[model samples]
Target: MVIYIILFGYLGLSLLLSRLNIRSKIEDSAQYYLTNRSLKGITLFFTLVATNFSAFFFIGFAGESYRVGYIYYTMMAFGTSFAAISFYLIGSPAWRLSKDKGYITPAEMLGDQMNSTALTRLTALLMIIFMVPFVAIQIIGAGLIVSGLTQGAIPYIWGSALLMVFILVYIWRSGMYSVARLDVTNGILLMTLIILAFVFVSRSLGGISEINEQLMEQSAALFSPQGSNSTYSPSLWLSYMVLWLTCLPMFPQIFLRFLMAKKESNFRYTSFLYTIVPPLLFIFPVALGVMGHLSFPDLQGKAADQIIPRLLTMHLPGGFGAVILTGALAAFVSTTDSTLLALSSLIARDLYKPIFKPQLDEKGTLTVGRISILILCLISLVIAFFQPASIFQIAAMTFSGLSIFFPVFLAVLRFNYRKPISAILAMILGEVVLILFATIFSGACDTLNILPVVPGVLATILILWLGHFFEKNKD
Candidate 1:
């Protein structure tokens, strides 16, 4: 009962805070869709942290670590570090141009830089499609967090619905401002909870070295990047790294933060800080999972996914469990809010405005954005109720499409390609081919071995070349 109260009370307070922020800045603009270009250094730093630390970091990363062992941490941390480095390399250049031209979306950025509307819309549409699954996953994750903390008293549907309501209320009010503000607050709480949980769990499990010894004994390949079980092999691990590097940096949610930065310098600053913060923030969840391996060696039933929650419920005493639950909820909500906001902005500004209602003023755009957010949240809630896939699977599927998008844009960025039609055709072909590949060879991914992203990127290049060839002949 007390846990339920804490959950509901936290939701109410977060909603109230969101509304206050929204009303306070009711005059905020379409320009503010990526943030108003007025953010200070600290605010931008938190936004980057908040954007990257999605529900996946908690549930997926730790779960992967728990199942695979410490070596997986190196892979995750390596992927994350590579992403940060890419931001510095490619993203800094993009940010400078965005400042010069006042760009709001990556679609706009790509379109403007490459001079291709078709390419812009294609990227925007792909972003929206991929992000739907991503946002839905986060919503589902929030529901899971609520359900777990409440001991299954609350069904996943109602828990998800409650989160959806809180998110809609908050986002409908402040737009990106509310998101940025809340992200900072949520990041701090997340850090605190991580430290607290580590302390509590470590004490419960004896200590880090003892935990390490048990981890090695229970799974011989605990420190082996070769993978503990046969499920992940050397080639497969390399493919996983390739897939993550290709897809994650281009994630619309992450890119949206780069777009929101105050300036090019801000992008660099925030990106640097985001690099350090995530690995540290990530270690706690990893610790929880590793500790789980040590303490409850024979535990089953979603053990990896439930590491933090199980630890809290069994190891941490008193009110701290509720507090940790709130932090996990904050993690879910932060990811969901940013994702839903980015998706809605894409729909309203990039999809609807350019196509149907090009005459909308800032106020009109704001109205459309808020309405789109409401509609998107409602649709996602319906999907969550069905529970079609696990949260991790949903995230993986979302990125599978986006992995194709990244390479196409990289090609454009490298070549300075002016043909929008070619770019669009390439993106579509890449996505379709990748989907076909995944569907056809789904069984072979394990035995024969091929990372999904490689084929999509190759297909993108082939299509672009074909499109260019045809266009030249037509000319």
Candidate 2:
């Protein structure tokens, strides 16, 4: 009863907050999608952090840490901090271009810059394809957290769909406006709970020193740079570093943040916060996952994703655990809402408006976008049902999937590359290479010790460069 009350209460607060923020009548794409470009300073900072760190951050990071050990921290925390600087590098120019051109979606910006309608459509399609898996990762995380906490009372599908549908209600009402506003509240709650859980979990386990001593006696290889199983090889380490840095900012939701910024300084402030704050907060979950080895050493694979919930429910006090559980729910809600909005906006603007219904007015686009949200929710829920892999593995796969397109974005945005074929080929072939390696060439990837995304991203860059070279010669 306590858990149900807290869950419904949190969802109710989110719905109320969205109602308060949403315009009674959304009249234009500008108002509905980008929030009139008003996001700056603290609101923008919170939304960016909230969207970037999801159930994936809390559950996946902890689960990966439990599986491999401390190396997950260096890969995720420090590496992601380094990636945050791209906000200024990539965002500033995109903001300037969008400001001048009234660009709303990423495909719109790329298409205008490349002068290719084909590129615009393909970009939208590819991003949607790659992003659905990411959205599913959020659902998967939510399912694991909820079903684990309830011990099968709710079941994973119901647990996943419950939050997925609840999130859609707010986002469909006000679009990014509501999503961004909700992000502020969830971001604060998530950080506070993470810090509290870290401090409380360490204390409950008898302190950081005691936890460290136990690990030293039980499995000290966990402290090594290579981790317990040497899972993070030098090549693999390099792969993840590239994956987080290159692929992270290119996430359509994060990319949308660049479009939503009010000024260059907003990017700077948010970037700095991302660099410093997330890495620190991550210490909480990663450390919790590490210490979990002492008590829950038998937990393995996808079961490990339950470490945070397990620790809180069984080992910690009930009230504090409920508070922390709310934080987990907040993480799922915040991220899935943003992801759905981004995917819907891209489909509405880039795909539906241009290709299928060139006559789409703001009202019509709004309807299509709302409909897309429902469809995506259903699709993500279906994917969540399969439980194909661990949350960490699925998250990594999606990260790499998106990373394959990062170079194309850089080529168009940063390098003034004008060949649409190059961008299109990069998108198609990068994904093709990624698929081949992950599927038929799976064993080869293992033998190579480098992940498929490395070659995939490299393929994208190579094609873009060659296109630039040939075009330069032709000109």
lDDT of candidate 2? Answer: 0.82
Error of 2 at 71 (Å): 1.4
Q: Relative to the unseen true structure, what is the C-alpha lDDT of residue 48 in candidate 2, on a scale of 0 to 100?
A: 89
lDDT (10s digit) by residue, model 1, range 240-357: 6667777766777677776676667777877777778756666777767766776556655466677777777788864678777788787888878888877777777777888888
The segments of candidate 1 whose C-alpha lies over 4 angstroms from its true place after superposition are 12-31, 299-303, 389-395, 465-475
Cα TM-score of candidate 1? 0.91
Candidate 2 backbone collisions, by pair: none
lDDT over C-alpha atoms for residue 332 of model 2:
84
- Work out candidate 2's RMSD over C-alphas: 2.2
Residue 400 CA displacement from its true place in model 2, Å: 1.4
TM-score of each: 0.91, 0.94
Model 2 lDDT per residue over 299-374, tens place? 9678888788888876786656877888888888888888888889899999988888898788999899899999
Model 1 worst lDDT run, 10 consecutive residues: 21-30
What lDDT is reached at residue 447 by model 2?
93
In terms of lDDT, model 1 sits at: 0.73
Q: How close is candidate 2 to the true structure, as a TM-score?
A: 0.94
